[model samples]
Target: EPEVTQTPSHQVTQMGQEVILRCVPISNHLYFYWYRQILGQKVEFLVSFYNNEISEKSEIFDDQFSVERPDGSNFTLKIRSTKLEDSAMYFCASSGAGNYGYTFGSGTRLTVV
Candidate 1:
């Protein structure tokens, strides 16, 4: 079965540093999303991308965050600067038809010190 893949399953970074989280979504999927779970909080949507463009983004996805599909198969999320509050499990998800049938990566746990 096809599945989303994330790299560096765990990352520890200092505050003010930059980090790029990588993902390879299912090849057949058309929509991609970046979501984060801050510790005990519910999953929060950060951004959605399709056709190599950002379709929607949440308030939490400010200038510090960026998403890109650098190649046909690779999707990435970059944080301009790390913050303690930024620590969380970042999930990469993709859907074949818009908002349905999503397949999520195991997730990359980022710990910002």
Candidate 2:
């Protein structure tokens, strides 16, 4: 079965530093998404990309954050300035059309000190 893969499994950075989390979703999937879960908090959606554009985004996806598919197979989330409050597990997911068959990556754990 195909799977979404994330890099660096874990990361630690100083507050205000920039960081980019990477993911490779299932090749055939058409919808891509970014989500995050702060320690002890619920998983929250940040943005969803489809047809090479942002289809939807949550309030959390502020100007400080951005997502890109630099390559057709790779999706990335960049934080311009990491904050202590940004420490969390960032997840990348993809799904087929009609919003079915969604799969989530293992996630990149971001720790801002």
Candidate 3:
């Protein structure tokens, strides 16, 4: 029953500030992903990391955004400059296999004011 864990469950930052969200997924999982849910919008995939590199990223992942696995167990997403629209609940997820379901972290709610 391994699960993904995220720190700083909540964060508040001023506009134009940089923000980093950290996460540690199930050690045994092979795929790691970052998703965001705007106040009342559907979950959107931001990026996916595999084999220590970005396997895929959505249009939202522009030059302002980046993802990294500094260590084998920790995955992080960094937003170079925050904006009001960037505020959302960010979730980290991991899956052992494509066919298997994902285990998501409780999520880190980012608030930009």
Candidate 4:
């Protein structure tokens, strides 16, 4: 089975710093997404991309967050400025056409201090 893969399994950054989380979703998937879990909280959707454009985004994905499909296989999420509250496990996910079930990456643990 194909899977979504994330880099820098863990990251540490200071407040106000910039960080880019990288991911490689399944090649055949038609939809991509980003989600984050703040420690014990439920997973929250940040944004979704389809056909190379942002199809939807949540309020949590404000000006500080950006997503890109810079190449055929890579997806990225950039945080313009890190905040203590932004620390969490960011997950990258992808789903096939007409399918809601997503294959999620293990996640990149962001630690802001």
Candidate 5:
């Protein structure tokens, strides 16, 4: 079965640096989303993009963050300026149908020093 795949399972970065997390969402899906989970915190939705446009975004998606579908299978999240608070597990998810369960990638653990 097709599954979402993420690279660099764990990343360590310094504050005020830049990082790009990569993901390959399940093929044939239309909607893609990014979520972050802080240690001992609930998963928070960051953004959802579809048809090359942002469908919905949370307040957490600020100016420092951006996302792109650089190719047919790759979706990436870029943080232009990282902060200590950015340390978390970033999850990439996709769903064929809205209101259904999402298929999440194992996640990229980003740790900012």
Candidate 6:
């Protein structure tokens, strides 16, 4: 089966540097989303994009964050400036809009120092 794949399963970055977390969603899916889990916290939705524009975004998605489909197969999340609070497991998900559960990437563990 086709699954979402994320790179650099683990990432370590400086507090003020930029980081781009990458993902490749399932081929036939249309809705794309990014969620983050801060250590033991519940998963929080960051943004959802469709039709080449943002459909919905949570407050967590601030000026420092942006997302793009750089190619036919790759979706990327860029953080302009990393903060200590930014350390978390960022998961990429996609769904085909049915009763099926969203498929999540293994997740990229971001650590800011």
Candidate 3 least-lDDT 10 residues: 1-10
* Residue lDDT tens for model 3, 8-107: 8999999999999999999989899999999889999999988999999999999999998998899999999999999999999998876988999999
CA lDDT, candidate 2, residue 83? 86
Which is superior by TM-score, 3 or 4? 4
Worst 10 residues of 5 by lDDT: 94-103
Candidates' lDDT values, in order? 0.95, 0.93, 0.94, 0.96, 0.95, 0.94
- Candidate 2 regions off by >4 Å? none
lDDT tens digits by residue: candidate 5, 26-113: 9988999999999999999999999987899999999999999988999999999999999999999999876877899999999999
Model 3 TM-score, 2 decimals: 0.97
Per-residue lDDT tens digits of candidate 4, residues 1-113?
A: 77789998999999999999999999999899999999999999999999999999999999999999999999999999999999999999999988478999999999999
lDDT of 1 by residue, 1-113 (tens): 88899998999999999999999999989999999999889999999999999999999999999999999999999999999999999999999875477899999999999
lDDT (Cα, tens digit) per residue for candidate 2, span 49-93: 999989999998999999899988899999999889899999999
Model 2 pairs in collision: none
Instruction: Give me the runs in candidate 1 sitting further than 4 Å from their true place.
Output: none
Worst 10 residues of 6 by lDDT: 48-57
In model 6, pairs of residues that clash are none
Best by TM-score: 4
Per-model TM against the reference? 0.97, 0.96, 0.97, 0.98, 0.96, 0.96
Residue-level error in angstroms, candidate 6, position 36? 0.3
Candidates' RMSD to native = 0.9, 0.8, 0.8, 0.7, 0.9, 0.8
- Candidate 5 regions exceeding 4 Å error are none
